[model samples]
Target: MKYIFLLLATIAGMLQLHAATVDTINVRSAQMNKDIKAVVISPENKKATSTLYLLHGYSGNYASWIKTAPHIEQLVDTYGYLVVCPDGGFNSWYWDTPKNNYLYESYITKELIPFIEQQYQVGSDRINRAITGLSMGGHGALYLAFRNQDLFAFAGSTSGGVDIRPFPDNWGMKTHLGEYHQEPKTWDAHTVIELTHLVKPKSLELFIDCGTEDFFFEVNNKLHEKLTYMNIAHHYLTMPGKHNGEYWARSIDFQMAFFAQCFQKVTLN
Candidate 1:
């Protein structure tokens, strides 16, 4: 009973890609002021075991992963978990703005997780919660997890822009942190790779992946190298590819699979 996921709606209009088996729900992110498209898929006639916050990268919406990686339904169906995709804002980079005063860190930590737990029957503890994202979001997931260790036990980033000093004009940094050269400390202080050593999370599982051909591979590599130097325990996987939806689409599988395995260990204990 395998079925393909859908992007554009046919006459049925946003129906299940797999014949009404997996539940696709479009919910609005009140903090972000946008509607998020999410999926809750479990084994047929069964409750979900775990939940994952599957974040998308820059210039992409919540539907990016579901559209590109049709196999996500396969992952959700097999693992019996809910995939939560929130709109991180187009090119928002998920950083808490200093001047503009939009606190994404607070929103995701204080609002979203609590709201999700209340609305859904999934386990509200760290064991049943995980976060992973690509590029901008990859950095975001790690930043959020490290800052709020109690909320998410497992976290990962793929082809993440861990270091942001290189791009002063790219993404939403200009609005978030002001000009890079003018406020160099502001930009450097918030970068995930730089802040890794500051976090002494009690119980957290961390992982990262990057493509050798990707433009941001160097930053991700620096993060891996630095984490190793700091003796922080994490899983780092480097493959050969560039920055594209396809690479992220495939990377999502690796991350979600890792999260699922970690959750299995947690449930056993």
Candidate 2:
């Protein structure tokens, strides 16, 4: 009995040791003058070559991705990369507010990326970095990457409010960008669809998808059409699902695969 117990314990210990580890880290942001919480998932292999920054949707914190899509840890292990899920604040839209002090745009691009590269053993180049998110975060991932092409090599969005100008009353956009009635131009300028012209051809690899029944499906389709019109290459898909966990959980798998392919291509080059 004693020997059997010892063998079982050894196997359990080995399984635990081989599993990916999740760490909650507080990253300080001088721009926001606050310590943001981020969930870092490190694969069993310590020598991770790349990093993926996952942002959460509105009303979500650092734990959103792991809670909704727990299989991301498995992706970290299979892809052999570090995954960083940062808190973008509830309804911050990952934007730098002009009226408020929510400078999340600067916090992410300026502070968070630098902190991650310094703290982790991941590569520190555009080709080694990727970003993606769902809903508001989906918008944010594209917004940030489109503006800062030098930082992220690939970007994706799942059911993103990509065109915020359409829904001014929802998601506290009026508070973040001023009342739509009062600031129509501001709303237009901040939208991801409006900013597609900023992307240079083949400068950034992109993936966008949304559920057919999602409220944002029409907007996503419009954004896709606009991108196609502008000749910006991207992978877009419309699947049968809603704007809930069931959709996002399955959608992330596709996005991760897309990023994995991008990472592989970069490595081969």
Candidate 3:
């Protein structure tokens, strides 16, 4: 009898996992004049829930998150929220580049967001919205949230390249901002580390974590220190791992939980 019960329980769990709905949505970006693709994960419950904008790393597409961390489907159902994973473009750095045709920053904030709210049953308040990502997406998440605090109340980054000044030639950032030596001001304006001043004391809640051995660990530490000096409250974590899918998969669990708590508080209020 006990064995039969266990089998039925396992099947029930699998069925619940399959209940979450995943859709590929193409949002038209009027600014960039392109159809940006995104993966939207909606819970089976049709109740009005908050939205979490999840981003991908450098060179990854909208499908990256669902492909790497498939459990996010279950997490969405558990938290009773929607997850939107947007494509940041190949090495676009999620920036409104001056030299390139990529206007991701504008597209995400102005176009895609409005479309999502109009089409979905998610809440449209800052208290009901959040954003986070891995690596380049991490930097993009914080960068966007800091600049647009009215849009997202909670933000997080896992193994993010928060400081782009040090590794000027490493990523394809030069293509967006032009040569680092030639365009120092542009780099400074676009980097997340330099945007610390935009964050007020409690305006934006942040969760930042990086593997101790990750190359971006030092930058994440510097960001934490700067925020500390500014008296901005945030959560900082470091674990034994490297910058890879393994680290992101583990760290996302905590970030989603943090966002869930924030959303729950707003709901209770």
Cα deviation of 256, candidate 2, in Å: 0.4
- For model 2, the stretches where C-alpha displacement exceeds 4 angstroms are 1-18
- Candidate 2 residue lDDT tens string, 141-218: 999999999999899999999999878899888987888889989898889999998898789999899999999999
lDDT of every model, 2 decimals: 0.74, 0.88, 0.86
Candidate 2 residue 109 Cα shift, in angstroms, is: 0.6
Local distance difference test, candidate 1: 0.74
TM-score of 3: 0.92
Listed in order, each prediction's TM-score against the native is 0.85, 0.92, 0.92
Candidate 3: list runs displaced more than 4 Å: 1-17
The alpha-carbon deviation from the true structure for residue 56 of candidate 3, after best TM-score superposition, in angstroms, is 0.4
The 10-residue segment of model 2 with minimum total lDDT is 1-10
lDDT by residue (31-144, candidate 1, tens digit) is 556555555544454576577887778888767677767777766655567777776667767777745646667666766677667766788888888988888888889988
Worst ten in a row by lDDT for model 3: 1-10
TM-score of 2: 0.92
